[model samples]
Target: MKQDDTTEGAAESTDAFGGLTPAEGLELLRVGELTVQGRLAAASNATLYCTVSDGLRSAACVYKPVAGERPLWDFPDGTLAGREVGAYAVSEALGWGTVPPTVHRDGPFGEGMVQLWVHGDETVDLVALARETDNEALRRMAVFDAVVNNSDRKIGHLLPTASGHLYGCDHGVSFAEEYKLRTVLWQWQGMPLTDDALTRLAALRARLADSADPLRQELDRHLTGPEVFAVRSRVDLLLRHRVHPYPSPDWPAVPWPPV
Candidate 1:
């Protein structure tokens, strides 16, 4: 990941809140001035710090261009941006709001995925939090990772804000047709899902059942037909089992540099 010099300019004068709500942020990303500030070093792929503004309001976001994506043996290149958007769509469809607002648009580096930059408490240790059984959000996220076939779920990817809301990011490798659910959240393994979790799973399964559903249509743009079918199959399997899945013995159970 290469860093670019910060673009010079002040935020537009519009909203009182220097930050934007998820809905507003999405619009801004669609038609706004995207200025690349720098590169995020923690990411393996090219992730840029960007500010999007429509001259009335401005929002801080991360931009990941498909052109800069590193080739992976299992996942196809140039699909990461679309996957990111698909993850956000799934999160919204479930009404979980676990993923920060994201959109696919043309950026400084061409078409890419732009997501609202979440400000979280760095003091919080996600690894330790993942171990605690009390965090229901983390548990839901784990289930979500399973449904999406997330290949990466590092501790650092879990962001907890001061308001106690948790958000997950870096979902470019998700929604694969294969069983690649590797993550640090295994504390709930073998445990039965809560009634609420089951309800949400049922809702997601129902939405995906309709070929013309908005969520399915949105995901169809990002994933292949078979890949989308796999997501529905995973949801069905989870509903049938109603228990947290155990790690697969054939593949590495957790991500590297878990934190």
Candidate 2:
């Protein structure tokens, strides 16, 4: 994977939110004209660089239309966009701002997922930072991945912003009912969860338990009932154990092209 450190063009990049908050970004994505800027060649599905504008405000974002999705034997077809939005909902519900603001809406290509693009700062070495097992943000990401059963949490997905915050993306393969938590961030394997982490997990468990939880309701739109149930189960299991999970011997612990 190529290392992206070019802050010089960030002013013109898609993530240039122009001081817009995440909530505002979501609204822009909903109402803005989604003009395709380019295609992201590395993704298996058709991922595009797009801009959304409402005549007054505009923002750069990534767009993944459901029609462009390739079939996966493991995951049901045409649901990748929903899973992406579901991941964002789960992230916000946990109060972990790990995912950039994302929404599922009608786009230039049809129904798809539009996300506020996150431009990572080239200054921070993400690989080096991942090795630091005690990094709070990474730790929370690990927990978030575990809850979502993220199957692709490669180093490239971990974006470090100029503000010193880390944001993760490419969650189309998450929320699997099966055990498929593949990621490169296993630095804290077997370590006990911090008090703060435990507190967050408890809070998340309670939220998921609510029958009318907005996040769960949103997730139901994209995920199968069993998949959503599995997410709650993972939270319960994590809260019960209170430790970082070890990799399974049956499956690959980390993604290929680790960076």
Candidate 3:
């Protein structure tokens, strides 16, 4: 099997198959047959590159099986896949498009997180992009990482696509009840949130409060009660403070091998 496709790498080109809406993509990933094409060896987890097909439509995707997940002393065994899905849910709620269409479902390797593969723009300098203060996309992602309590947001996770969209992946270590945010995009630290961001956060906070909301239901399925509650708490804090958070002194300010 071919290898060497890191999340930072220009992935197997799939721009032609990128026409599907997020809803359509989610449906395909949910019920389609997944055939593993290769392994993304750079991933810490068992991340398999695959194609999902419902006969008429097919697209490249990344599948990280729960069985292949490495144990972290802090996270419960077999829960990483769910956290990945939970992150996708939050991204969708925020309407930020930071995460690709991802779903947790049964695959060749058993149940895991199946995410649409993103073909990153090879020309963008990710290091410089991460350090920029005025890049709206990266700033939005920083807020996202804060809300999810993402413990690992390396420079390599940034995906700047040719379609003028910025996305990020590798969120299997997110949504802890404690404040564990660590990231490379801290240029907006302590800055007041933009009006647009506050509007989105308010909508998300309202949706999260409604127990009957689909977002709440989906989050419940993937996250523990306290973890889900913690997401709400984070949003509340952001709205109350109305500013991007500072790095937590209790946790590492940045991930190792930041790139």
Once fitted onto the true fold, the runs of candidate 1 whose alpha carbons sit more than 4 angstroms away are 1-18
| Stretch of 10 with least lDDT, candidate 1 | 1-10
Task: Please name the candidate that would achieve the greatest lDDT relative to the true structure.
Answer: 3
Per-candidate TM equals 0.91, 0.91, 0.92
lDDT of 1 by residue, 1-259 (tens): 1111111111121221235656676777788889999999878899999888888888788999998899999888789999999999998877666788889998889999999888766778666787877677787789888888888998888876654667789999999887888999988989998887899899999999898999999999999999999999999999999999888888889988787
lDDT of 2 by residue, 1-259 (tens): 2222332232233432546767788788888889999999999899999988999988889999999999999999999999999999888877767788899998878999999877667777778877776567778889889999999999889887665566799999999988898999998888898787788788887877786988768988889989888998998888888898888887899998887
Best-to-worst order by lDDT is 3, 2, 1
lDDT on C-alpha atoms for all candidate structures: 0.82, 0.83, 0.86
Give per-residue CA lDDT, model 3, range 150-220, as digits (tens). Answer: 99999999988775567899999999999999999888888999897899999999999999999999999
| RMSD list, candidates in order | 7.3, 4.8, 5.6
The TM-score that candidate 2 achieves is 0.91
Candidate 1: give the clashing pairs: none
Better of 2 and 3 by TM-score: 3
Off by over 4 Å in 3: 1-17
- Which has the higher lDDT value, candidate number 1 or candidate number 3? 3
CA shift at 236, candidate 3, in angstroms?
Answer: 0.8
